[model samples]
Each structure stands twice: as structure tokens, then as C-alpha cells.
Target chain A: MADTQLEADVTVNAVGSSCPGPLMELVGNAKDVDPGTVIRLQSSNEGTEPDVAEWSEESGNELLDVVDRGDHWDLYVRIDD
Target chain B: MTANRPSVLVLGAGAGGTMTANALRRRLDADVTVIDKGRTHRYQPAYYLIPFDYMELADQERDTRELLHDEVSFVEDEVTGIDPDDRRVEGEADSYEYDVLITAVGNDRRPDAVPGMLEGWNRTDSVYPFYHASAAAALGDAVDEFDGGRFLVTVPDTPIKCGGAPLKLTMLMEEHIRKRGLRDDAELVMTKPGAEVFGTGPKAPYQERIEEIWDERDITFVPEFTVSEVDYEEQVVRSAEGDSLEYDLYAPVPPQYGHEFVVENSPLTDGGEYVSVDDNTLQHETYPEVFALGDNADVPTSRTASAARKQSHVVVDNVERYLDGRSPAPDYDGYTACPILTEEGKAMIAEFDYEDSISAPIVSRLNWFLDVNVIPSLYWNVWMRGYDPVP
Candidate 1:
């Protein structure tokens, strides 16, 4: 269950990051990236699943995939066109 | 398990109340009505971070409505008192009847408990108390303008939400001054009503480590000092024990007491404040149908959110058992944890029960990671949302 096959345009390593940190980073970087770009976010926080999903949908982005990486998680989101 | 759906009424949408209400929702198949004073549910531990600019004030609060399960009925009103004999609770707009009542109306912050504390709180830039978010934000500005002189942090004798907060803020201030290159310009001093820097229990090992930090940093530790009044004009703080200290910048931990509803209405209170409950079961000592937890309950332990976490489990279990026609178990052992942030990146986890048995690695970055990263996220998404693993 790896999202590595998608070849993310930008890899955001938020492994050590906390709650709003991971989500805020994604939102900030999502604005800079071109549309149709896939950004991979890594977060160790347990709230990442629902928080990231809600943020992606609310911001009109597509959550492509979520891969649990044991202690952390890899959430892939694509910028909305 | 009973014939009719049990009616559960809870007061205060805080850690203990929210957790107990949600946990009961999972097992009891009951109609739960929650009475909260406001719509905002605050993440209080984050208050400590606001002054240091580690977190924003807005991020510390959430809609209390969203924290509860959909099945639970929410009431937004001010609670006046509880008529325990009638098994009814008096609220501002309406009254509620309950089969089981849980009062989690935690400690109320009384800045005026000590004379002159609130009078000069925001009026002067040199004096600030960071116990609440509004005050914490004000303290942030004060910390910015304060470049030197004695930075005094004092705690009143009354029970506080988090006993470690005063020390944590003191430590954070020391780090902030040093980081801003004002270390030599400022002298750090911490005065508390208690004789020990930490409490007199399993906190010894951690206290020893803290004392070492204070020694190395040249921070003065004043014990057995109860701040009675603050002379804002002269920037002097007088203690009840007839001692005084001068400071250019002061951060005081305000005295905290139970909600007036618990104190004025029911026989559940002792000393005219603080709900009296069975220390282990968390049930009201006099009224069997009523229960209490969080800072509001007089449990004879350090008043911290961590203690409430453990107490929540016992309350939930005992409440369920009580409904099932069984005696409540004395399960709560006063388990309390404080993830004391030593610095921005490093911290320590102080965990102990009633027996005063200390846990391991008194200080580490691991605990800091849990506090800063994992705990808040879990608290928001899981615990408060009725998804806690316990029970």
C-alpha cells in the first residue's frame, strides 16, 4: 500500500510535525504549486487522517491516496484545477 | 441494560465532562444532555504555548458542539445550582432532570483572589498572568518588551488546573530570555506556596533534575511563599507569610476555585467550594447519584488534565456499573501525568499514582514530541470526539 508509484511532484516531510503544522504546511505549499500537482505529506500525528481529508475537500483539492507508514503516514493530495 | 433508556446529565463541556458523556454514550444506550456555559471548548494546555508564540490563541479553541457525539443533546446555558434532593439541575434558561449527574465544571480562575493581581494585570506592561488565553497573549507582548531585571513567576496556594504550569512557564521564560540574548540581563525567580519546587510526592526525582537546571541557570527558587498581594505601582509582591519580592516583570499563577453552582447549591461541596467526591470512584460522597471530576472535584491530588484523564475512565466505568445495579469500584489511583516542556524541543513526562511511584527517564525529547505533536491531535480528533480507547 505505497503511494510511491504516483511520483509526487513535491514531497513534504512533516514526520516530526504536529497537528496544525502538517495541515498548514500542505495548505501553504499547495498555493505555490501548479494545478494537477501531487504533494505528499508525512505526519506522525493521529489526527492527520481526518484533518488532512477535511482540509483537502474544503480547499477543493483531491486526496489521491493515504498510505500508513507504521509510526507515520503518507498522505497524497493533488491540487485542484 | 436497563428497561428504560437512562437519562444522563453532565455539566461543563470540558475534558472530564466531555469524555464521560461520550464514553457513556457508547455503552449505556442513554440520552445524554450536556449543559455548557459557552460554545467554545478550549485546549487549555495550549495556553502555556500562546505566551511563547508557540501557538496562536484562536487555534486553542473549538466549537464545543463539534466535540460531542451526534447522539448527545447539547445545552448552551449558564448553570446556576443543583437541587440534588429533587434530582434536578438549575440552568439559566431551563432545568434538567437526570438519572445520573456528572459535574465536571472545573476550577474557576480567580485573578482577584490575591489583592492587586487583576488590578494591575493589563494596566501595566511589567505585570502579566498567563493562566488564560487573553492574559497569555498580553503576557506575550510584555515578554517582548521586557529586556532585563528580575522576571518573577509566583503561584498562589490554591489548587490550579495544572500544577506544573507555573514551573513550566518559569522554565519557558528562562529559555526565552536566553534565546533573546537577555539571559545575563535578567534574573529568574520562582515563588510558590508549597515548600517544594514540585509537590511532595513522586515528583522528587523530577524536582531534583529541575533544581539542577535552576542551579545551572542561576534561577532563584523561593519556597513556602504564598503571594498575598501585588503592589503594582512599586512592582512588589507580598506573601501571606510576611515575605516580599521585587520584580521588573511578573507572571503570576492565579488562585483557582470550583464553580459557584457546585459550591452554593449542593451539599456536594466542602470548605464552601470544590465538589466533594469519592477520591477513587469519583462519585459524590453524600449524593450517590451525583459524580464529579476534573479540577472541580476535591480529590486531594495535583489538579492537572492528566489526572482527569485517568479519573474519567474510573468515573465512566463506575457510572456504568452503578446503572447495572453494582457497587462502584475504587479504581482511580490518582494517576497523573505532566509533560513538562523544559525547552522548545526537550521535555519530561512526570507520571505517578497515589502511591507516589515515579516513572522512568524523568526528562527526554520523546515526551516533548508526544506533548507537542501527538497529544493535541489525539485530543481533538479522538478523545473529545467519543473515540477514546478506554471503555
Candidate 2:
């Protein structure tokens, strides 16, 4: 069943964060949270939209709330079970 | 009572648009109106890593309203047509006339420009363009499913925002798979249209650095090739040189060209269709009151934000000067900069202009940190605010 419940959430500032840096932040934060946690990451990578979605889905995590703020991004990823 | 500041109009809210808006807001006393079809702004340079599932989409945007000074007028509307004869811009819902117009409407990636691109993009994981937001994310998904095969990255036959981006993706992706213990399982390949990594001038140090990294990594480099079509079914990508590569995951950078709308409508555009403006002054070739900056204009240099920043100053000065009936001689030298990330925590800062290359940093952890850390802060707190200095 799809875990309909979103438990905890946090936001990361990936302003100039590109590539490996943003991924490092995501992986590092995901480790600290319990299962079913959704961390909302905001980035300015104009290229982040499809990238975050693909990553979350590929890793078997739920990705949601992807928005473009012109120069930055807001994305939500649910921690896997 | 009047200091002779020209009433300026700027279109679009991308890097060039914002730079012109902020720079003019600070320099000229004239009323400035910035028109953007959308309210959200995405810092495009940061998108290179989305395919690795490295960054979140939310981190890429900011409110256009927040980035502006209180004096700069922000109008959210899509332009329908430009009436250069009468100095007017027609939008979907409204029309506005201006004494001086700054055309900074950045180009969008028209996937339809290529044959079968949209369908091939939606259908397959073997091919993608990193420059697009969705393509980068899709690339990330493809990488996750990648069990181990040839990983191909191709550059199209055209000018793009950042010339170093494709190479950067190759480096970062290599690092990602290596960390995952799949280095031996996957083969990394680079296909580009340029004869060398960066074909621009002042190229010794940067070229040597890129050549060094090309050899150090197992990444294969195929130069002077253009991707003609995508055979998604067979998972093979064909190039102009008649070479085909079958891949498990393919990331291709699309060829960039001038914005068709302005080029087609305006007689000021060159035959190939880019806004023709003074290289130094950034003023229109025919209309003194009209100016352009960034990717849309026919500036003979690498189309990067760095070039835009320098040009923004000249645009502001000339606008003010044109109104004052004074000569505006603020000349831009076509300087562009991109800190090429050779790898995680290792970057070769390549800063160059139409003539000279400025960034030749000694290899160190500091340079890498600048690309990954410091530049982000600069882009946000400084450059985006119109304070990016000229070197």
C-alpha cells in the first residue's frame, strides 16, 4: 500500500548547491530521519525539476511538491520504509 | 529637476532580465518596468546534477517579486508580439509602450525542434538532455535503474548557456557511479560537437586541465559529432559522423539557437535570427532606444550569465545616456565565466572574455569549495541582486 501519511519534514538550501553537493545533503539528511519522513528541499538549479523526481522515484522514495521559484526550487521527498 | 534617466523596459525574468533590472534600478533614476511571463525564477546553473538524484526541485526557485527593489515595476504577462515601429510590446492581456526597451527574453528549450524528440524523450531512458529540468530528473531515474552498461552523454551542435555544463555532468556522474561501486560495471562516454572540450580562445590552461581529466577518468571523449536522431527502441543514438552508440543510459545536451519570435518579427535580427545589438553598448543596431542582452542577442561570445552581468552595466549606462542626449560609451568586452567542476571538490575555474581568459586558479580544495559552496552564495546574495562585479 502507498504510505499516505507524511510524518516529518525539513528544508535544505541548495542555492548554489549543484550535483554532488545537493545529493550529499539529501543522502545525509535521509539517514537521520525515521521511515515515512518527507524532507522538502529547495534549490535554484533550473535543472532540478526532472532530476529530483527521477532520483526519488528511482531510489524507491516518494517525491512530491516540486515547484519552481524562478531562481530556486522547492521539492519534497518521503523517506523510504 | 530631472537628471535625465531614461524610462527603461525589460522583458523576461531570467538571468539576463534580472541582471538588467537590478543594475538599472541601482544606477538610473528613471522609472523601470520588468515584464515576465512567469513569476517564478529558477537559477539555471544549479540544474546540472538533477539526474543523479542529487538536488531537490524546490531548491531551484525564488519569487520574482522578492528579488526586486521596491521601485522596479514587475509585470507578469506573456508577450504576444513586438511593435518596434511604434515602440510597443503586445502581451496576451495587455499592451505597453516604452521610450527604451531591453529585450532579455531568454530562449526556451523547444524539444520539438528536433525530429521525434518529444516522443523519444517520453518513451526512453536511454536518451535525455541535461539542460532541461525534466530531462535532468529523468536522467536521475535512468541512472538509478542503471545496472551497468555504456553511459553516454552527448552535446548538441549549437551554443548553450554554459559550455562547461556537459563536461561537468560527465565528471559528476562518474563520481556518483564510482561511489555506488558500479564503476567497472558501466562505461562512460562523451559525444560533443566541438572539436575540443572548450573551443573558445585563451584556451591553453583550461584545455590542458580538461585534457588531463579526460585521460584520468575512464570517460571516453568523442569530439566533432552531432546527435542527428534518437532510435529509442533499439537504444542507439546516431550522430552526424555516422557513428552509433547503444547505451543503457544516455544524457544529451540539446542544440541551442536564437529565439525565433524576436528574430522572425524584428528586422533588427541577423539572417540566422538573433537580435543585433552593439557588442559593447548593447543598444539596438537600428533603434537607439532598444537594447538586448544574454542568449537572445547576437553577441559573439559564450552565452553565460557572466557575460550578461557585464553587459547589464553597459545596458544601464547607455539607457541613461540615451535619455540625457549624452553619449553612452559603456563598452562590454564579452567576458564570460564558468567554474568547471572537474570532480567533487575539484574544479577548474574557467573565466574568459571574447579575448582574454581570467580564471587560472592553482589546483586546490579551495577552488572546488568555491564552485560547490561559495558561488551559490554569490549567485543568491550578490549576483542575483545586481552586485556581481566585473573583473
Candidate 3:
């Protein structure tokens, strides 16, 4: 399934946030969610993709995919077991 | 004898001072206090957007009391001078003693630095400066009423906060005039003291591209011209090298220097009238317990907020290491970034360091979005809040 189409266990709304905001929100909220749960993160910041990509990799979270939504983006991250 | 907590006194609650104070509060058990002349804290980069009427002065300002961490004590008083030997700052009302002193009072516009710069400033509507809010707003009004004649934008002979501001203003005004149907009547002239528009640094390519753009846009570039006097009555700009230009609207960027109080009182200042610190460590060369950052530090680079952000990290780390009783290893490499707004929605991100290499000018709406959207939010929420998560 497309990342944007994936059923998310938790939706992290980072809309209207800037660089590192989406990433910081994800980092802060990821611990509350259970393992194997896919977290949906949305952001409009241009510097978000690379930051989230690197963060997910470094934190052992599985990044499902990043989808461009014109004005913003939807990033899916699956928490690691 | 009563035991007093080791204290850190930060001078000038600007970007560098605020960030340093907040970061140190988290890392140390010391009492962190920040002192400034006023309670107003500004996201100065937003000043550039004002003249174009994209933002208002209120949008760029936040009270320093609210922006600073609650744990960090905030003092709103004018600093008269610092007695380096006594490790105390004499303020207008009271004196503050510190175990460690960090001076972050950035260089501010000195209209009097040049002969005619201050004399003619704001005396007439024909001459305006866009570096400050009031002046920027006035300049905006002037630009709006300008029907025709020469619109001259000038750069200072000294280093400035944003190297891209003068060019950005010229470019934006060109588009504004064109949109208002006055392009043919108004001639846009960019005058700089240097032979080159931008220094022969990593910004060369971007400068070259700008040259091309200006040429195609019918904007004239006058190089190696310094404004020595502005004959506000006669509407003439005179350069020290005996060159002169007549203009209906003159936007001058006067030379900037360190805070008068800090420069005159503290022996930490260099010949440039800024704090003399190690390029990397940001620690004062003569006094190890004293450090400086931001535009006030004589670091042989353009004074920029981006440079201050980078320097903040290094200064915080070294300060922590110093308190831990270790020799400081300087790690700052003069990294700075300037988001050059080309038109309304397009900008180029110019990122480079002390090394004469630059990231090729990346011009796009996305970059503009970062400046108009991302950077400001990050500055207030992440950096100032003392949570610089990004290294």
C-alpha cells in the first residue's frame, strides 16, 4: 500500500510546523506508541525529509515511505520491536 | 564565608547571548543571568522582509523576558562598561559580578561611522535605511510613493549582519517598481564600496548569477564606491574616492560597530571594536574565562545570525568543557548561511564556511519556503528555547 494510504495507528500532525519540528514531534511521540505501530507524520517544511530519513534510520524505526503531497508531505514510520 | 553558586553573566540578550545563556543553564549548576539594554528581542532576519511589506515590526519582535528561559535571570538595564579586572559589569543602576563573562552584544549600525551617513539620516524622506524597523517602515513608505527617478541602494564599507540584504532589497524593489508600472521611469542602481558585489568567497557563483540577473533586468551596478557624505538637501551621495551620484531615493547601509558601552569599557575588544576571541573556541584570547559570540566577535567573517548559531554551539560546548576543568578544543569552522530572496516567492540558499567553498546557489520556491517558513520557527522554538536538538 502507498505510504499515504497506509492505515496509521497514530497520526502526528506537524502541519504549519517548520524544520526539525516534524522530526522533534516524531521523536517525542514515538515512545508512547507501541512496537509495530505505523505513525503517520505530516509536515510542510522543506528540510524535513532528510532529517526524518536520517532520524528514523538512526533510531531503528522502519520508515514505510515518504509521499509528496504538493504543499506538504506524509511520512510513515513503523516503530521497531 | 557564605558559599555562592558559580555564576555566568551574559551581556546583550541577542541571539548569541540568549542561546548561550539558555544552553549553559541546562548544562551547568551555575546561576545564568542575561543582561540587555532593553526587553525587546527581535528575530533580526525578519527586518529584511519589512521594507518589502511582507511582514510588520510587531511580527519580528518578542519581549526578551518571555523568550528567555525562566531559570535564566533577565536584567533590563543599560550596561555602561565592564571592569575586566574585577569581573564586574557596571550598569546604569547596579553592577553585576560574574565568575564567567560572555559578551554577545552584536555590532549595530553606526550612522556616524561615515562622514555624511548620520548627518543626513532621516532628516529628509529622500534618504532612508532599511536595517532597522522604523527606518524599514519609512523606506517602505518612500518606495510606495516613488513614482519615478533614480532609486539608489548602497552597501556599507564595513561587514554587515546579512551580506545579501542590499542585493535582496535591490532585486525586490525592482520587481515592486515593475509591478507598479514605474520600471521605465525609475532607474535602479546598486552601489557598493568594494570592487566586487560579493567578496571572492564561496558566494562568487551566486554573485555571478546575480550580476547576470541585474544586467538582464536593466539594473545598473556601481562598484568600488563608498558613501562618504549624503547631501540630503541637494539629494547627492558623495563617495570618499571623489565619486558622486544623484538620486531621488537613497537607501544607505551605514557602517556598523560593536556596542559603544562594551567597546569602550572592555579590554576584550579588538581593533575592529569587537570582542577578540579565538576563531574556533570563541574564548577570549587574553581572558580564558571570558568568551564572545555573534556579530560582536571579531572572527574575520561577515557578521551573520547563521554564523552566530554555529558559534553558539561551539561556545556552549567549550564553556561546558572549561567548567569541567578541561582544555577547550575549538570546533567552529565559520559556517554561515544566507537565504537570499530573489523575488517574492523565490530565494537562493547561500551556505558556506571560512573555506572559500560554497554550496552551489540552490534557487527555488522550496528554499524560499524554508526562509519564509522553517527558519523563523526553528529560531524561536528550538534554538532560543535551549533545545538545539540538531547538531
Candidate 4:
């Protein structure tokens, strides 16, 4: 099966955060989760959604889904390595 | 001595040090330790206007106590030594150990950098360096009482916080003389060490603007002339290259140097005597637990508060990584920012990284407005609070 949130073992909640907040939160939480688990980042910094997801994508993590809920964004990423 | 929490000792409470302490407290749960020698913290940018009644020096300074809160453990003491191997910093009255140490002790203006800079300062009113709060008061007195003559500003072969400050004073004085209807009577000359006016090539708009003002105001530009002597009595400034410029009113920026504690304590500093850290990680090359930022770091860039704010991110990140037992992700792009104030109304905000690359242009009033009003408030509020607007 294709690797996605469906096969994920972890989830990260980085809600109510902004630019560096979301990224910082994600980076900090990324260390604790097992290598294959998924981290779901939620934040209101619309400007940093693509940035966070891109950072995750480049750093050996699989960006599963990015959803903008107007008030905030839910960035889903599965830690591949 | 008996804090309930482990302390994070921060040395120096100036722009870089203050920002580092405040930012650390806001981000981490550890106890914050801030040490500085002075009871008063002066907002230095306002010094440019103090001579011309644009701002007050007293208004620029704040009770250092008013700036700190319950979040930080404040110590009014001068830093004497730092035992990085022992992880302790020696203050005037106490020695405190730190879980993490941040060196924000900023640069000091040395009147002795040039041979006769200090001598001229005491011997004549014609020579003044915009290096301290006192210099502004002295220069203000000089500007107000002068009737008319040649007002000269010489920039030494050293790096200053605001690169354009000396020249900015030159322009404002030209405006001051013009307003006083002494344009024909007063001749303004800027003696500088560099070839360009604004430093960045992209800021040609600013360079052209300054040159235009120089032409219109009849202010002469002397480039690459390092000041050698200040003959207060003879009213002459001799460049090290044997060039000479005469002036009735002379303003110069004193040479800057690193703190003695750092130079004497650590082997990290170069001949210029700054903490030689990798610009991106901000961690000491030989020591991982030690990190430095701001004016003290030997980062080849314009030393300004704007640069410090950007460096704060890198410092914060590397510190967090070190706390997490992971190798630092080196990502500091040597970002630096400066707001070149053309006048009371016009300001050009310049932001760039290690390459003199422009991050933001001078077109926006928001950035200028940030420099004039917003950033200063945020510096006192958020930056001092250990919180940064990182978006």
C-alpha cells in the first residue's frame, strides 16, 4: 500500500501556532515520535503552511495532507525515516 | 543564590543580550538570569536626533528594572569573568552557574581607537563621536550654539552599529543649518572609510538620494580616508593616508572593540577580538555548549539590532537542538537588517543575509514605520519578553 496517514503510527498536534511556532513545535515533537508515525500540525499562520509542509517533505518526512480550515491549517506528515 | 529553578545565565543586557534573555525566557521553562552593569538602558537610535531637538536622551533611556519582570532574575552587576569550562559567570557581587550560557555582552565605543580621538574630545568641542548617550548631549550643545562654519564628520576604520549614523547626522545637520538659514555659511563634509555611501549596491536608490542631498546641500564626501589625528586647536583632521580636512564642527564615531572579559577569558576571538562562532549554528567551534550572537560574534556583517533579531532565530534553534542532544542544523544565512533614516520623515529599511542580498526593499512604509515606531516598542515589549514575531 502507498504510505500515507492510513499506515501512520503517530500524530502531532501543533495547533494555535504561527510561523516559527508551528515549525518549532513540529521539529521538537518530531524527535519523540517513532520513525514511521505521522505528525499532524495545526496552526493559524497561513503564510507558514507551505513552509512547514515543505520542510517536512525535505527532511525525510512524508507530507500526507495539508488542509486549510480558514481559521487554521492542519498539516499532516508521516515520519518516513 | 537560592532560586527554585535552574538558571539560564545571560551576560549583557543591551540590544543583543537583552533580546536573547527575553527570547529565551519566553521560549523555555528554565529560570532566566540577566546581568548588566547599568541601572539604565538607553535606546541608542534616538541619539542621531538628540543634537537637533528631534528627541531627548532621557526619553530614550528606561529604568532597566522597568524592562524586566518575574520571568527573569535580574542582577545589577558588571560581568568580571566567564568560566565556560565550569559553566559559571562571575558578576560583581555573585557568581552564577548556568544550564545554558548566552553571551550578549555587546560592543563598547573606544575613544582611544584612533590616536587623538579621545584627546580631541577633552581638548576641543570641535571633535565628538556619536558613541555614547553623553556624546549626543555634547553634540546637541555644539549644534545649537554654532552660528556658522565647516561642520565635519569623520568615520574611522572600524565597524559601528548603525553604518549610516555619522552620515545621517551630517544630512540632518545640513538640514538644521539650512533651516537656520546658514546654508551658505556652514559647509558640511562627511569623511568615511568606505567607498560607497549606503554599503549595499541594491540600495543605490539610497546612495543616489544621499549623494543628491550632498550636492544640493554642498556637503563634500571624503572616501577611504581613515582619521589619523584630531588637532582641536588647529581645527584640522588628518587622514592616515596624509589627506587633511578642516572643520569648525567635527563629529566622529569612536572605534569599537570587544569586551575584555571575552578577549581575556576565551581563545575563540580573532585579532578583531570577537567570538569566532559559525554564523549559522551560532555554536562555538571548539565547544558545542557555548553559543554567541549579536555584536560580539565575529560575523562579517553590519552590527545592528535588526541583525540581532534575525540572529535570535538561529540562536534559539541551535540552543534547542543542543538541549535535545542533537547536532545543530546549520541554517543561519547571515541575515542582517538596517534602517537608513534619510530624515525625520523618510527612512529606508534594508534587510539582507550574508551575501548583502536584499530580503526586503525600501519601497514599503510599513518597514519604515516599524523602524520609527513599531520595532522600538516591540523591542521593549516582545523582544525583551523572550518572544519574537516569527512568521
The most accurate candidate by lDDT is: 1
Candidate 4 lDDT, B1-391, residue by residue in tens: 3354446777777777777776777676678777876556778878887888767766677766677766777887667677777888886568888877778777767766677666566445567666555566668778877789898887778777777788778878888888888888888888787787666554555666667766866878888888888777788889878889888888888777787778886555754578878877888877677778888887877787777777777887777778778898788777776676655566666666676556544535565576767766777777766677754
Span of 10 residues, lowest total lDDT, candidate 2 chain B? B116-125
Say which prediction, candidate 2 or candidate 3, comes out ahead on DockQ. Answer: 2
Ranking by TM-score: 1, 3, 2, 4
DockQ of each: 0.02, 0.05, 0.01, 0.01
Q: How well is each residue in B135-216 modelled by candidate 2, as lDDT tens digits? A: 6655666677778888888777776778788888888888888888999998888888768876646756787878777788
How does the DockQ of candidate 3 come out?
Answer: 0.01
lDDT of 4 by residue, A1-81 (tens): 332424435544443222333554465455445787777776655656676666665577777777667555667777665
What are the clash counts of all predictions, listed in order? Answer: 0, 32, 0, 2
User: Between 1 and 4, whose DockQ is larger?
Assistant: 1
Lowest lDDT sum, 10 consecutive residues, model 4 chain B, at: B359-368
Report lDDT (CA) for all predictions. 0.80, 0.73, 0.79, 0.71
Local accuracy of candidate 3 as per-residue lDDT tens digits, B280-318: 889999888898999989897767888888898888888
Best candidate, DockQ: 2
Ranking by lDDT: 1, 3, 2, 4
